[model samples]
Target: MSIAKKLVGQTAAYGLSSIIGRVLNYLLVPVYTKAFLPEAYGVVTYLYSFVALFNVLYTYGMETAFFRFANKPGTDQRELYNKVLSLIGSSSLIFTAILLLASGPIANFIGFPERQEYIVWLAIVLAIDAIATIPFAWLRLQNKAVKFASIKLINIVLTVGANMFFLVFCRQVYNGDYLPELRPWVTSIYNPDFGVGYIFLINLVANALQLPLLWKELSIFRFRLDVDQLKPMLRYAYPLLFMGLAGMVNEVIDRILLEYHLPDNFYPNMSNMAAVGIYGACYKLSIFMSLAIQAFRYAAEPFFFSQANDKNSPQAFAQIMKWFVISCAFIFLFVSAFRDEIASVFIDESYHSGLVVVPILLLANLFLGVYYNLSVWFKLTDRTQFGTWISVGGAVVTIMLNLLLIPVLGYVGSAWATLCCYFAMAAVSYFLGQRYYPIPYPVRSIIGYIVLAVVLLLGVFYVPVQQVWLNYLIGLVVCALFLVIVAARERLLFFNK
Candidate 1:
């Protein structure tokens, strides 16, 4: 129970930055949706999907490898950190240069030949972010959750500030909306034709600032190549790299597929890019679930490694899983219950047509979180190959389903594909985890909470309440009922410990 408390505390610390930062970032969805047309915003969406994929490649699982090896008995963590940082730093430089050189061709390939600068800016952003991962991982491994959160919050704050400066203030001034006196200053710095390019440029500038903030952590990093240590770490991380790539496929390929496969004029008077923009905007509705998972992961990865040798680890893990699912299930229910309100508040009406997929995407992210929890088995046991295969299988499912359904159902098909893929991965990981690592993960209770959440969400959708206020009252009641049941069942766990 104390272990659970510690994990919860650390997660809360991490969640401070992740949840708040993401909410702030989520605010940008409204700004962007309003500022750019759906087609323009779709370009932003399409390009960033590739950014997510390349980000995995840039670090290539080295952060996880550092954690695994650092915890080994008799290991010198400082030297290990030096080696990991050196390898990533060098590789990032090479990768960034190559991408910069090919920026034009790459932009042309993505159908954005006029915007090669976006590719260049994102390349720099990716490299800086990749190199910074080790320092951040080092912070987590050393249990510096406060410092970690502080740095993350700083980065996001700067990112958000820059975004507002360029997108909101400058754009508005340039358009003569307000502050006409500042138009000359805004014009001197901002190009109205830049359009969505500011998003990438601001991101690059924000990521660049992280290097100075992480200077203390990076100061200890020495430029050294320890080939002997490098070989073993690579062996461990290579599978994870593959797994990460496959996982990215499952996560982002739907956007890519939707961009290419949706029929022209599929929606009434909407192009494929417009549809992609709508899907991307609606997808932001799932940010709460994704943020929760990210916070848990930031704390739980190192926690799992530290607890790997404990005699009672299985029980502790089982309890952790129960609480994690309970929390996520509540998020699922709350978000699904208020999906319409959230959509209206966060995105333009032009994008509201895609709101139907928000619940599906939320549930999919819930299962993705479950899969992350279950994946601790492979990471702890040094059987990362299982993770590789499971993620690949999920990616295959995502692809096949998207291909079969996108033409028929559009972005809705992509949402269902996401749900099916994540559910399948989580199920497979659970069975394989039981066979290998064998944690008693309160499977019955976990399933019960999820099923109950789904049923309540259905009630929220189909309940015969004509008045909006009455409907909101019932949704609140449904959420309160869930909390009441959870508190009643888990009273002993809370009070006893």
Candidate 2:
């Protein structure tokens, strides 16, 4: 099959899983809003943010490293996999052991000592998921997008179904037919008092369910560990570990800073989990950008490596990067135009306070996606240190802005910080990539699209009608005009024939 066809097929399969998976996960927002207080859901938000950061730490760039080394000529593919797998497995084993032993101290440090069990179970969950990361990447390397997406979709379905059972159906069952002898079990399950603990429990269970689906991949493993290959892969992966850590800090440090710096008195005085919940819910509004980046990376990473020796490889990479920027800019403009209504999709009315962050953060993620595309040049050239420096710089900018601005402007400051951080990283990567592995990207056209997006965003924000529906209708028309212009420009550039 042609690469284009393969990509189209792979993306379609993965996109279904991604879109469906996000839909299922989005269901949890409403569930939590109705089932638990905003404060309770805030707990869910905080822990998962921490989970995202630690998952990056525990995986430690090995998934990408596995793909890099495993694709090299004359490399023992199986041995390469085994080396990385063993490394991650051993690290996870040790990490889980420590987490189990030190759950109390860890929980206390995070200010939730009473939820040590949460820490313990989730740490195991993270370890399991981390160890599975290599196998998942292997599936992608092997062109197993269907199976890969199947596993992911199944995981999402199981998670969403379990959460519904726990938070919604469980109450209905207890209230209706199952109340007589099951009262204690029902009461234990239906913690009307607790907030968003059920979401974590459901995630833990869903992630556990993925083990059986991954058994086919796991069974391919040989027990042989290759120390010779391990040394080089470790060398390659170490910089990525720092880069990944810095990247995630850019993505999530806002939530961490909020939890740490926000006054304890703010929530109850404000009549709810005001700041955290708002930030958390508004964050979800950017899932469009995240999902687009993820789906593109799934295909693009291996695709780029596979074609590394082609004479046209640089041209192809440039094209891919341009298209990625164009699509992401389009999504940013599209989503931002309708964010006011999109903000209402989550259950709690109070969360609407953070809606303004959605458009800002969506654009930040646009820059972030572009930065990812640019950073790939460093990875492809094996000059990965550039990625580390860029990400660290971005992280520093993100932290400084959050610290300086959050005290004065609250979550909006964090959103603006994210935008600035990503914009800076994208700029740095573009300039540095030109120095190292220059690809003649369509810089003019890409910048044109960005300018068009910004102009349309201004139209949406500045031109407002009192009726919400009319305002949104006008915004959609404005976005469609931009889209039509984009489509015309793309055709003229690529298909003037």
Candidate 3:
């Protein structure tokens, strides 16, 4: 299949899971936002942030290593897969066991002393997901896009269905079906009146469904472990561990810090917690850009490894990067043009304060997508440390900005901090990639798109289109103008035709 066709297919497969999954996930926003108070939702947000952190830790760097060594000559791909799979599996079991035993202390450390069951159940869920990462990675490497996407879609659908049943449908039918299973600790601390245990119970059920689906991928491993190959792969993957942690830190630290910095009196003001919840909810709307980036990363990483030895690999990389730029620019305009409307679907009107942060976060995601494109250079060259340093630098920028600005600017400050982090990271990585392994990317044409997007966005933001339909019409005109500029400057239309 042609690259374009394959990319289209892959995008569709990914879009099926990501877009559909997110649409179902969006159901939870209204469910939680309406069912639970903002403070309660904030606890959900805080714990999920820790889940994101632990996901990075548990999966570590094996996914990338699998892609790297799986393509190398003389490497027993099956054995290599088994080794990493075994490593992640054993480590997850040990870690989950440890967390289970220490659930009390862990809950206390995170200021959830009364909700140790939350810690324990979620730890099990996370470990299962973490262990599944390798098989999922294998599926991607083998281009089993349909099967991969199906499993993902089912997982989300089951999760959403379960959540709805527990949070909505089953609430009225609450019998003594499982009340005895609730521990004294849970009964004492948790309000049985609220019926919040359903969240964890539903997650537990949905994650367990993956075991049967994963059996096919697990069966592919027939070769035994090779300690010799393990050493070098570990050496290569260790830096990536730090890089992943730093990258996630940049992504998640704001939420963590917000919870940490919030004062005791802040809880009485629903607006304060509401602002955070609103920001978190609307931020998920930016998944359009993130979804594209993730889909590309899934395809591109393995594509890069497979083609790294080709004589024209650099040119291929440059071409793909250019098209990625065009597509991302188009997505940015498409999302921004309708964000005023899109924001409403994510939450009730009470959360509208978050609208101001949406464009900034969307633009930040564009920069992040670009950074992901540029990062391939370092990964291919085995200079993984460069990526780590770049992320750390970006994290520093993000931290300092949030620290100085959040108190003054509120959620908008966090938005700007994110923007700065991605912008700086992309800029730094582009320059470093050129120095280490230059690709003659069309800088002038790319900048033209950037400039046009900024100008058009400014017009959308400033122009007074009070009527919702009229504003959408105005946005379409601005978007068309950006596209025309891109076509004219790059002759994209002529070349495609």
Model 1 residue runs over 4 Å out of place are: 495-497
Q: Which lDDT tens digits does candidate 2 get at residues 1-497?
A: 24544555666666777877887888878777776655666777778778888898898888888888888889888777777888889888898898899999989998897888889878989998998898888888887878888999989988888888877777666666565677667877686545466666777888888888899878988765666757787788889989999998998888888877765565445522457767887888899888888777777778777877777666766776667777888888888888867767765676676788888898899888888778778999998888999999999999999989887778888999999999999999999889988887789988888888988889888985788788878887988888789778777453121
Task: Report the lDDT tens digits of candidate 1 across residue range 277-305.
Answer: 99999999999899999999988998999
Native-to-model Cα distance after best TM-score fit, residue 424 in candidate 1, in Å: 0.3
Worst 10 residues of 2 by lDDT: 265-274
User: Candidate 1 overall Cα lDDT vs. reference?
Assistant: 0.91
User: After aligning candidate 3 to the native by TM-score, how far in Å is the CA of 236 from where it should be?
Assistant: 0.7
Candidate 2 stretches with Cα past 4 Å from truth are 1-8, 172-189, 263-268, 271-273, 492-497
- Give candidate 1's TM-score: 0.98
Off by more than 4 A, model 3: 1-8, 171-196, 220-228, 262-268, 492-497
Q: How accurate is candidate 2 locally (lDDT)?
A: 0.81
Q: Model 3, range 1-497, lDDT digits (tens) per residue?
A: 24444555666676677777767877788777666666567677777878888888888787898899888889877777888888888889999999999999999998879888898889899889987888888888778888888898899899898777666544433433455454443445444465556677678778878878889887876544565757888888888888888888888877777765544454345555555676677777777888778777767777777777767667666666777777788788778878868766756666665677877888898889889889988999999989989988888998888887777677688889999999999999999999998887777777777767877888888897678788888888988887777677667642232
> How many clashes (backbone N, Cα, C below 3 Å) per candidate?
0, 1, 0
When superposed on Cα atoms, how far off is each prediction in RMSD?
A: 1.2, 2.6, 4.5
- Clash pairs, candidate 2, are 40-195
- TM per model? 0.98, 0.94, 0.90
